[model samples]
Target: MDDSEADDPNRTSPRPAASGGWSRLSASRGFLLLWGAQSVSTLGASSASFVLTLEVFRDTGSAVALAVLTVMSSAGNIYLAPLAGAFADRIGHRRAAILANVVLATASAVMATVSLIGPGRLLGLVYPLVLVSAIAASMLTLTLTASIRRMRQDADLTRINGVTTLLQRAPVIVAPVVGAALYATVAPAYVYVVDGLTSLGCVAALLVVRWDAPPLAGPRRANPFPGARDGLAWILRHRGIREMQIGFAGLNLFNGLGVTATTAYVILLADRRWGSASGLAAYNVSAAVGLVAGAALAG
Candidate 1:
């Protein structure tokens, strides 16, 4: 491609290149707004998830409850991935993203209400709400990524993805301890309230930010299922994505159980000796430190 075409902002799905770092991305105000919104949402969701874990373990003290909660949170996202992608493609990513935020905000409100009713009394409802929130969150992430791809070059996408991963992991470093402390000092409902309000902040940012939406090839058909099927077929034809998907499938299979089991194990350890919150927070922070180190190295 010539210089003009290479620099064209309207291009979609450009081939990957070695773009310059944060300087290029930061120059775009729209990207900054999206990044900032996502940062706030990530922090809120991270802290809320931590608090939920604490609440469930504190009440049931059963590994099974934690396992069930983790499964519900993940299963919905896995099941909805293709549908969410198709939905984003059908209605412009911005609209889909806004819709996802609305769902997340509403889910947070419902959870807050559930907390007020007491988690034990409303445990059944809580599981479904968590699943809903997870599904919305996955949709929001997919749409935001599609927005990024539409707005920036592939090289810029790489840097932005790195930075975004850092933003997402940054919360894991502190949210656990902060959430646990808040839960112990205040009430669990407050954590949910904070998360809900932060999500509103993200929605506000999304509303004001402006970007060019990529045009669809044609009008979406009445049924999205076929489009979703085509997308899956496309992925299957790509060796890299196919392999990556297989790897992720295996990773999730093991990682999911290990993660939930570790939480239960740590809580049990804390219960046997030290304070529960501190121990759980320490373990979380420690793991997050490794993640931060890895991110820094990758950057």
Candidate 2:
């Protein structure tokens, strides 16, 4: 998920019932199921993402197109996040999460079909499908994250948060290796099918989780813009957070460029390294090392 979700006001949802401490949460079927499902989905999505990037670069050989894809995703997320979050709040997180997974699974299946038959390029289907998939993913992330807070009580908040943080970041280490191997061994369309299956697995996990997930209280607003405005207003009133947001904005301005450049660089390095897929795996490991280190330090 993007860091932007953290700052976005519309991502907010109703808090889960205080279920006790970390020990209690550990024993809670709902928390365990959600955590497990999220972990699997994250790893699968990460692998699928690398595969998609590899296919895009291999086909088009254009980092610019990949960059454009990122821009499209950003625009879609920013525009639809409020409505997505609101919809999640309306339906309850469990249902919303399940639906989001179903959406992703369906999208992956469609993309796979397109790739299977399309000539060279994707017959102009890649970007739109990718955009919708991203939007669903953002919604899923928001709801799942909010659900975590609700699942546990305040007593072990710090520890529970740290553990969840690790769970979220650990996939970076494993996914690249797995993705690279899959890319090297399987057809791209088959890899996409695998991605779709992972999402369906997540749906299964969510279904088995029995939780009394209540919808967001108060009258359902016809327009989410007002809530979004209120959220922004609240953030603006906080000097430190507002300043932090500004700093983050500056960082994000160049992040897309950096991501594109890095992806191209890695692919070029992969070509030079002979076994291109394996080389990509190595790069992913190095990058993951940095992420893990950062998470460790933050912890």
Clashes of each: 0, 1
lDDT of 1: 0.77
Estimated TM-score for each candidate: 0.78, 0.81
Per-residue C-alpha lDDT of model 1 across residues 1-299, encoded as one tens digit per residue: 23543455533332233364443443466667777878878888888988888888877877888888888877767776767777777766767788888888898889888888777667899899988888888878887776666556665677877777777677768788788788779888888888988888878877665444543566677674776688899999999999999999999889888988898889888867777777888888998898778867997
Model 2, span 172-220: residue lDDT tens: 6889888888888887788778888989988887766534456778798
Write down the lDDT of every candidate, Cα atoms only. Answer: 0.77, 0.76
Q: Once superposed on the true structure, which residue ranges of model 2 sit more than 4 Å away at CA?
A: 1-27, 76-79, 118-120, 227-246
Candidate of highest TM-score: 2
Distance from true location, Cα of 216 in model 1, Å: 3.0
How far does residue 22 in candidate 2 sit from its true spot (Å)? 15
